[model samples]
Each structure stands twice: as structure tokens, then as C-alpha cells.
Target: MGVTGIGGFFFRAKDPKALAAWYAEHLGVGAGPYGHWDTQAGPSVFSPFAADTDYFAADRQWMLNLRAEGLDDLCAALRAAGIEVITQADWDMPGVGRFARIHDPEGNAIELWEPAG
Candidate 1:
């Protein structure tokens, strides 16, 4: 599979469900199977940052996520590019999606998740 696109972006919020609902209500992302912005291809970044990692700066509010077509393909590309891609059984949400974790050059935790169809 080739790198086609991204899926969804998730982040930590004081009130995530509320915020998600807000985005759903206002921005309209959580509408249903199809959302306001539905990504059919590419990659969906699924990073979960360390509570203390400076990767997510104190003031900075977003984690940059690049979507991919397949986690395995993307991981292969990243590895070929000399990037460190971390994988574990616990990270596999196959029922939910497939996921991989890695950090940017700056040490921020990045999660790459692909949702189950």
C-alpha cells in the first residue's frame, strides 16, 4: 500500500469528550461514520504523549500528525528514512485500529493509529 492520507487527530483536553462533542457540534467532526472531515486514505496519527515529555510544550497546544495509508508501510518508510518506530502488541487496536508509536526529533511522543473499518 502507498501513503495516501490521514484519518483523525486526537489530543488531550481538560474535557476531551466535551471538546470532541464541541468539535462535533461546532466543527462537526463526530457526526457519525462519515464526519465533517473524513479521511479515506493517507495516515491518521494516534500519538499519546508522556505526561512529562517536553515534546508537547507547556504552551504549545497541538501535536503535529501526518496521516498514512498503512502503519506497516509508513513504519517501513520511517525505518528506511532512519527514523525509530516503536511497536508493541498493546498498541495494536485492531478491533479499533492499528497503531504505532514514535517520537519526533524533539522527543515528543507520536502515535500513528489506523481506525477499523
Candidate 2:
């Protein structure tokens, strides 16, 4: 009838083991005995920003787009944990929903988006 949901996100990592550990410590994502992430619920959005994206400055090498169910809540959670969350006025689309950006320990930009749910 219709497409259901995303399976997984794959990206190149300079140090996959280290990068994976950073994500696990900061964003709560990485393979665990609990079986992946056991929080929140929603269909994830998968899209890529252009190579010359002004959305992320040139110093950053990669961009990650994440799908979150409670966008605002997650933003607060990340903020509370002392992570630098950057909200872009231009990135928010009318009906599609909103987007916020942040970087990993390795300085890779990650775009977190919440579609209308």
C-alpha cells in the first residue's frame, strides 16, 4: 500500500569505532545489549545536504540528518546535557516541520529534523 519506514543510516567514518563510541556517549545511539535505541517513536527522514552547503561551514567534513519523534523535547534533552545545538531559521519548512543542527565530538555536522506527526 505505502512505504513504511527507514531501516538504518550508513555513513563513512574516519574512525568508525571512536565515532560510534562518541555517538553512544553523546546522542544515545550505538549498538547496545538493549538492542539499538529503545526510545521515542516515528518514521525517520533521510536526506542529504549539498556538498557546498552553507548550512554547515566548510570546516566541517560531514553532515548527518536524524529523524526524531519529539523534536522539541529532544532538543531540550540535548541542550541540558551541555551539547551545542544550533537552530536555523531558514531550515524550517512550513508543513514539513523543523530542523536543528549540531556537531559530533569529531566536528561533523548533524541535521536533526522532525516531520509533522
**Index of the highest-lDDT prediction:** 2
TM-score of each: 0.46, 0.67
lDDT for model 2, please.
0.75
Residue-by-residue lDDT tens digits, candidate 2, 39-68: 456656455767887767777655677766
Candidate number of the best TM-score: 2
lDDT of 1 by residue, 72-111 (tens): 8878877876778878786566557776766554454556
Shift of residue 99 alpha carbon in model 2, Å? 1.0
Error of 1 at 53 (Å): 11
- lDDT of residue 100 for candidate 1: 73
Which 10 successive residues of model 2 have the least lDDT summed? 33-42
lDDT of 1: 0.58
